[model samples]
Target: MKDFIFESTPKIVFGAGSIAYLVRELNILKKKSAFFICDPVIEKTIFFNDLSGKLKKEGFIVNIFSEIVPDPDFDSCDMARDAIVAAGSDIVIGIGGGSAMDIAKVAAITAKNRKKAKDLVKNPELCEPGMPLVLIPTTAGTGSEVTHIGIFSDNDEKLKTGIVSPYLYADVAILDPEITVSMPETVTAHSGTDAIIHALEALTSKLATPFTDLLAEEALGILYRNILPAFEDGNNIEARSNMLYGSMLAGKAFANSSVAAIHAFAYPIGAEFHIPHGLANSIMLIPVLKFNLNSDIEKYCRAARAIGVQTTGLSEAEILNRLLFKLEFLLDRLKIKRSLGYYGVTESDIPRLALSVMKVTRLLSNNPGEVLLEDAERLYREAM
Candidate 1:
């Protein structure tokens, strides 16, 4: 086994009714004021209103910044940090999907350190732990709640960059299945696909450790079995709970082991085209899997089995082929039609996207196989 180190800070509280514990957790942390970061859609939800009301009733002054946009940018982080400082909040709570959580994580650091988001992006280690932070995930994907990496788009560059440091990990993570019950069917499918991809990529990453492998395997299994049921019936509390738990495990695994080429390629698509991160990941999944297959056949086969593919009687090549087919089928079943062309991506756009992929060497270095510029261009073409 290769040498490896593991560390995480989030104390996870998980269950169907775990949102009720937010007040208790804040009290334990002695937090008197809160700055909530969330998407505008979530801000209008009854669930969010009720939760905000309860926190106010408990004597915790709450200020909400609900301008969080998808594929959040550095400017948004700066805005959120300004809000946190202006509110004089003692705690920062992120209460939605990856975008909300990511902004909150970086804003917390920026608020306390009094630094620019761009400066911190250039040197993630400069980010000091800031304010009491609580992350409540309303989506079962991204695993942003337990991760130490916060991703955002760089508008000037038209690509995504991540601030990766232990300081970004949440102090507490509350996973309440009831909150996810309101997800639209498309959100459920895309988010679930993202979680599964996290496990798969982590398992195949060059930094994969025994500890991460164990978590990734179980996460894959749970996600494979429950994603469809959850997508089909949004109100299935049991399925929703399992998906959330599995996503958190996947997040933990990837946080330690790291994700690789798929994420590297997905970043540009999301940043440039406004594609949802989960959907961008799904579009690139099979192409990148094929690229990495030759690097570690055994690991890929194990991943196939982990996702519930039967490999008992198949050769390595057959198993890999079957696994690819199964993934394609899953995407179709989940109503994720495969084709970049469907999303308005053209052959002329491949070069720019490939160049963008090259810039994400942070993620590319974790890939088990070498991904050259030509390989990236080919992957984009294949995705199309």
Candidate 2:
């Protein structure tokens, strides 16, 4: 095994009612004034308002940056930074789904550095040490609350890009399942599957080490056991708590080991089609797994077993085939749509999508198997 270094700095508070720590945590982080960033959907919800009000009561000047949009683009980050800077905010708080939290991280970094949002997204090296941030996630997917990567789109050029830096990590990540209980069943299903993909890819990463694989295995089992219950009955606190905890574990696992093929392919689908990130991931998981089966069949078998698919008395190839069937069963049971065609993608767009995938070599390079241009194109075709 290769040598590895693992370092996670964020302080995590997770449970059914962890958001209650917001005020106390912010004070400990020395945040005198906070810019609470969120999407309009969440901003309008009672959860957001209640949190905002409570923060104000705690003597923090609370400014709401509620203009965040889906798959948050450069423009949204720019708007958020402007709001934070104008408010003279001393701290950043993210209180919604992944997009909102991701954007909030970038916004805090940009505001502290006094640089344009475009500069940070376009030139990640320009990042200066940032102000403190507290991430209170209202969703279970993405784990932007803890991860060091932020994805955004450039609307003018219609391209998706990423900014990766340890400096962007939140000082604290608050995961409260009560906040996630309101997620629609479809959102629950998609995000839950996305978390599963995170663990699966981490387990098979070329850089995988004992520590990350162990985390991924535990997370995969937790997700498999609880995701469906959370989806079918939105108010299942136990299921919600498990899914939330599972996603955090998967985030940490993948953050260290890296997610490979599925994410590399899913980025284009999300950038071009505007599909939600988790749903895009769900649509691509099985096809990417099939592509990856030949690279590490034993590892695949282990992953299959982690999700409770028995492969005893079966050959490696047989286990893989059974794993794909099991994945299909999960997708069908969750009612995830299977085709990019439904998202305005056509066969003619395959060439463009293929080219876009080439840009995500950062992720593609980490897969156990080589992903040639032709190989990526075939995966996209199969997914379609």
Candidate 3:
């Protein structure tokens, strides 16, 4: 077993009606004033209005920053930070998809540290603990609620960057499946695929340890079994609950063991094309899996088994082939049929995308196999 250290910081409250405990959690954290961050669309939801009303009734002064957009940029983080500071927020509560949570996490840090998102990305160590954070993920993806990473786009460079530090972990995470039951089928498929990729990448990462492997395996199993059901029947509370828990488990696994080439390569595609993060990852998942197939055959086989692929009396090569077929079938089943060309990416774009991916050494270095510039270009071409 490789030497490893596992530390989980978030106090997780999970189940149906888990949001009901929000007031108790806020009280326990002594939150008098909160800077609530979420996507603008969420502000129109009855759930959002009800939650805000409840908080206000509890005497918690709430200032909402609902300007978060998809693939949030540095400017968005700055805007959120300014809101947090100007509101005199004692705590920050982020509710929505990954973008909302990511912006809130970074804003919480930058608001206190008086640094811009770009500055923090360049020097994550400069981050001091910010205001208390409570993250509620309404989508079953990104796992940003449990992780110490905040990803954002650089609009100038058309690339993605992240701030990775322990200070970014939420002080509390509320996982309530009721909130996710209203997601569209496409959202469920994309988000579920993202969580699946997170588990698989963490399992095969060079940094994977015994603990992470166990968590990733269980998470993969849960996601594989429940993602389709969740997508087909969004109102199925059981499947939604499992997918949410799977995403959280995957987040905890990757937060410690880290993700590798799939995430590294997905960033450039998402940044340049304005594709959703989960969809970008879904498009690239199979190609990257093929790229790393030989790097750690045993782990791949174990992953196949975890996802319920029968490997009894099968050769390693057969297991891999079956796993690849299974992944393709799952993609088709989920209707994630987008290719690089579907997003208007061409062979000419591969070089730029490859170079951009190489810049994310933080993620690439964790790949089990050496991913050369040539390998990156080939992977992009294959994904196309």
Candidate 4:
């Protein structure tokens, strides 16, 4: 193992009905006025109404920026930043999935440092200390609450990029599984699968340390076991709890080790076709795994065993085959689309997509195997 550094969110409060911890966190930060960033869909939820109302009753001024758009773009962050500044909020709170949390992170810092979101989007090094920010995840995926990385979709370039800085870490993260019980079946499937990918990619990353491997192993086991149950019945509290915990663990793992070619393949399709992040990851996973089979045979075998694959009396290749079949089974049972053609991606698009992927050197450098232009085109073709 190489010498490594592991960093995570400063504070985490997790459990059933733990959303109430928000007030306590605000008290600790000595903040009374709060600004919320979320999608319009989440703003209309009864849960949000109740929480915001209750906070207002507690004498905390609660303002909302509910204009967040999907795939979390620079425009969304800039809009939310303007809202935060107009409200003059003492604290910024993000409530929703990855989109809302990511937008809130950008809004918080931009409001504090009095910088435009576009400027920081181009140059994340310009990011300075922001006001106290709190993240509350209403879904089981993304794990944006614990991570300092925030992704954004560039509509013009039709590419996905991220801002990485420790200053983006939340001061507090509140994870209450009760809030996640309302996820639609599709959201549950997509988000949970994204968590599994996070773990697997982190496990195979060249940057993986003993610390990250421990987290990724535990996260994969829990996520793989509980995802189906949670998908079948959203009200399953135990399953929901496990998925949420597993997602956060995966987030922590990937945050330190970084994800590899799987995520590198996910970005272009997601940015161009407007496909959901998790679903794009879902289709490309098997192809990239096949591409990386020779990188380290034993590690892949260990990962299979961690996910309860029956590897006894099986050769390495056979164990790998079983692992692929298991993932296919999960994707089938979850009703996730496996073909890129399903998203309207054509043969003509493969070259550009492969080119875009090669530009993501930050993630490619962490891949278990080298991905040349020909290899990327082959993987994209396979996925298509």
Candidate 5:
């Protein structure tokens, strides 16, 4: 094993009622004005109003930027940043799911640096210092609250790109499972599968360290046990909590170890079709796993066990086959769409998508397997 270094610096407040800490924590920060970015749907909830009122009572003026859309684009990010600056918000609160949080993160950073959001999109290397950013997650998936990465779609080019920097890490992350109770079953299923992909990718990353491996294993196990129950019973507090922790652990693991082909391929799907990141990940994960199975047979066997597949007395290849079969079975049980063809992908677009994926060598390089473009193109075709 080569020497590896790991550091995750987000202050995490995690529990069933941890949402209540928002006011108290903000109070301590002495930030008189704050901006909140969330989806319009979330803004309509009573929970948002209650929190807004509580902040007002605490002598804080909260401006809500509820213009966030899924697979957020640069123009919306610029609009959110303009709102943040016009409101003169001293602090930023990212509320809701990954898209909202990611938009807020870029907005806050853009405001603090006095740069247009488009600047970061045009010149990703130009990000400067960022303001105080807080993350409050309303879902059990994405884990953007604790991650140092934020992805946005470039609509013109049909590419999903990200800003990855230490400055993008949230100062505080509050995860309260209560907020996830209202998630639609489809959202829960999609997000849960995304979390599983995070853990799966971390386990197979070239940079996987002992620390990350342990976290990935435990997170995968928790997700395997809890995601289905949470999907079946949306209000099950225990299941929600487990899924929340599992997602958080997945974020922590992958933040250090990085994601592999699942993410590399998912980006194009997300960019082109506006599919939810998790659902896209779910669609591509098994195919990519099958393609990379030969990377490390023993590693695949261990991953099978992590996901609750029995592998006792089986050869590594057999265990790998079992794991692939189990994932296919789980996807079927969840009724997830199996192909990009079902998502409206045409055969003519395969070459372009393949070429775009080849450009995402950033993620591909992290795979334990050396994923050739031929292998990547084949995986995409198989997925279609």
Candidate 6:
């Protein structure tokens, strides 16, 4: 056991129809005007139109910013900040996947704190608290709503960068599985896989404490059992709801304990290849887990059992072997691309990508296993 402190969003409203709770949270914050941020696709959806309509009907001034792209850039984030300023938004309501929520987080903070998105990336310690933010997830993964860490693409540096500060925490997070019911099959698989990896990495992070392990352990059970069900039947509300809850639990766990080298390895490939974050993490998970297993056999074995693997009477090696096979089977079932080679990454590119992983000390430092430059190169090679 170690001394630790846990922090999460102040308020979390969860369940099937919990999107309706947003207005009440807004009332508590006493914010009459909201800047609603989402991707252009979401803005065009019936769900977005209806939700925003409800806000307007309640006499709340609503402004829409729909310019967010996948793997959001700071330029887009800066534009969002300006949009909030122009709209005179009292709160920022982010309603979509990770990218949209990340932009909304930036817009909220910069709109009030007089800081640019890039400044937060560079000097997160200097970040000041911003306007109240309410996050609504239309996807069952990412866990962005409950996390203080925000990731964005730095196109100038050609890598993904993270900003970590308590100031980035949302005031309210609405986990409404009903909103995720309409998610496309591929999106469901990708997002759920990301949450699964979040739990897995957090379990073995050096900063992991007993409190975080409890949440991550339960999260693994819920996520592993429900991800396939949600993917196979998007209309299954029970499965969807459990998946959302699992994602949030994992978010809270990782928010305190932090994620390890899997994320560090994922970031470089995601930025370079334009792969979505979840999918990139999915690709890297098995390889990094294989590398980390020997570093903490007991915890890794517990992780296997947490995900429903029956490991009674099994040796540690056998437990790890079973976990790997189960992960591979799940990836196959979801049609996840398991090879970096499939995405056109080659042995020649390994050096450059591994170099980028070394720069993510924010995540790598927390890995249970010590990851060096050579280890990074080898892991990427294994993924290929």
Return the top candidate by lDDT. Answer: 1
lDDT of 2 by residue, 52-128 (tens): 78877777898888887788787788788888889998988887888888888888898888877678756777787
For model 3 the local lDDT of residue 115 reads 91
Model 2 spans > 4 angstroms off: none
Could you give candidate 5's per-residue lDDT for residues 183-285 as a string of tens digits?
A: 9999998999999889989888988888999989998899988988999999999999999999999999998899888999999988998778999999898
Candidate 3, residues 270-327, lDDT tens digits: the string is: 9998888889998888888888999999999999999998898999999999889988
Cα misplacement distance, residue 90 of candidate 6 (Å): 0.7
Number of the candidate with higher lDDT, 5 or 6: 6
Model 6 Cα shift for residue 180 (angstroms): 0.4
Q: lDDT of candidate 3?
A: 0.91
Estimate candidate 1's alpha-carbon lDDT, on a 0 to 1 scale: 0.92
Model 6 C-alpha lDDT per residue in residues 68-131, reported as the tens digit of each score: 8888888888999999999888899998999999888877888888778998877877766889
Query: Could you estimate the TM-score for every candidate?
Result: 0.98, 0.96, 0.98, 0.98, 0.96, 0.98
- Inter-residue clash pairs, candidate 3: none
Score residue 152 of candidate 6 by CA lDDT: 92
**lDDT tens readout by residue for model 1, 1-384:** 778889775498989889999999998899899899998999999989999999898888999999987888899999999999999999999999999999999899999999988988778776667777999999999899999899989999999998887888899999999999999999999999999999999998988999999999999999999999999999999999999999999999999998999999999998988889999999999999999999999899999899778888889999999889888889999999768888889999999999989999898999989999999999999999
lDDT per model vs. reference: 0.92, 0.85, 0.91, 0.91, 0.86, 0.90
Poorly placed runs, candidate 3 (over 4 Å): none
Give candidate 5's error at residue 305 in angstroms. 1.5
Q: 147, model 6: CA deviation in Å?
A: 0.5
- The backbone clash count of each candidate, in order, is 0, 0, 0, 0, 0, 0
Scored by Cα lDDT, where does model 2 land?
A: 0.85
Query: Candidate 2 or 5, higher lDDT?
Result: 5
TM-score of 3: 0.98
